[model samples]
Target: MAIINCPFCNKKASDKSAVCGNCGGKLGEMSVEELDRLQRDKRLALGQSLNNHAMMSLIIFLGSFAWYYYREPETDSLEMYAIHGAMLVGCAWYLVTKVRLVLYKRK
Candidate 1:
């Protein structure tokens, strides 16, 4: 195994090791370009995660509105309508955010 300096602790580390022995930080035989690409990929993944969360929130709000709509003894109440309207607004917000993030990823 080739010996290299650990980026985290500057200690001698073997290229074959997955982590630094001293600082327990990730140690890999990666070039500068590869490292930058890895970081970029991570940021993209984070953006994707945000999109997922937004979609989930939208689904939850829509489902709740559906459940409230179909419940038995449907008495027309202003409060019920208000609550459903709020849920719809929440769903719209999340949907917009998810779409924006997805479009941003394409660019």
Candidate 2:
């Protein structure tokens, strides 16, 4: 008899319906605590993904740094430039991901 937003997917659905049409999420009666738990689960999953990405970036940076030092290429050679660029990009990516994760956690 009423249109309500699906708690799991935020899609419009009939309150009488058994499940969300868009995401097939269960439409059974849910308490406020359950909704909060679902939201928290989503946030934690995203945070975990970001954390993994940050770690990968750090690994990439370390690998590039080690390669640069090991090769000891000429200062202006293409290989040296490439390795340096990769190191910078990895550092920047890690920092940005960490900042985003912090902001998301604050929210």
Candidate 3:
């Protein structure tokens, strides 16, 4: 088989190989159109995930606050505090992922 450059790692690999030796990335099996379609689908999935995460973050933040104000007891329980903390963490994670996605697009 011919030697081909690995798309993921930029290393030389055999075209016969199913995966890149350097990075273990899938390789050389897909047609050009199939590869393009796969990449398009992957990007679309990522964008959908980002949107879902952002919406979930916003919903959690707003819902937690609304619950705290309207339904929580006069003195907050440990569970309520934990819920808020978890929401904050989730929101932070979503924001960080969003930033990473933006940086990846720039590259």
Off by over 4 Å in 3: 1-29, 104-107
Q: How accurate is candidate 2 locally (lDDT)?
A: 0.85
Candidate 3 local lDDT, 15-47, one digit each (tens): 678888999988767655664565667667777
Q: Write candidate 1's Cα lDDT for 1-107 as tens digits.
A: 77866655657878778777999977566765664565577667778788787878777787767767776324677767766776887788787887878787786
Q: What is the Cα-based lDDT of residue 49 in candidate 1?
A: 82
* Winner by TM-score between candidate 3 and candidate 1: 3
Error of 3 at 8 (Å): 12
Model 3 poorest ten-residue lDDT run: 30-39
Q: How high a TM-score does candidate 3 get?
A: 0.61
Model 1 poorest ten-residue lDDT run: 71-80
Model 1's TM-score against the true structure: 0.48
Instruction: Please list the residue runs of candidate 2 whose C-alpha ends up more than 4 Å from where it truly belongs after superposition.
Output: 1-34
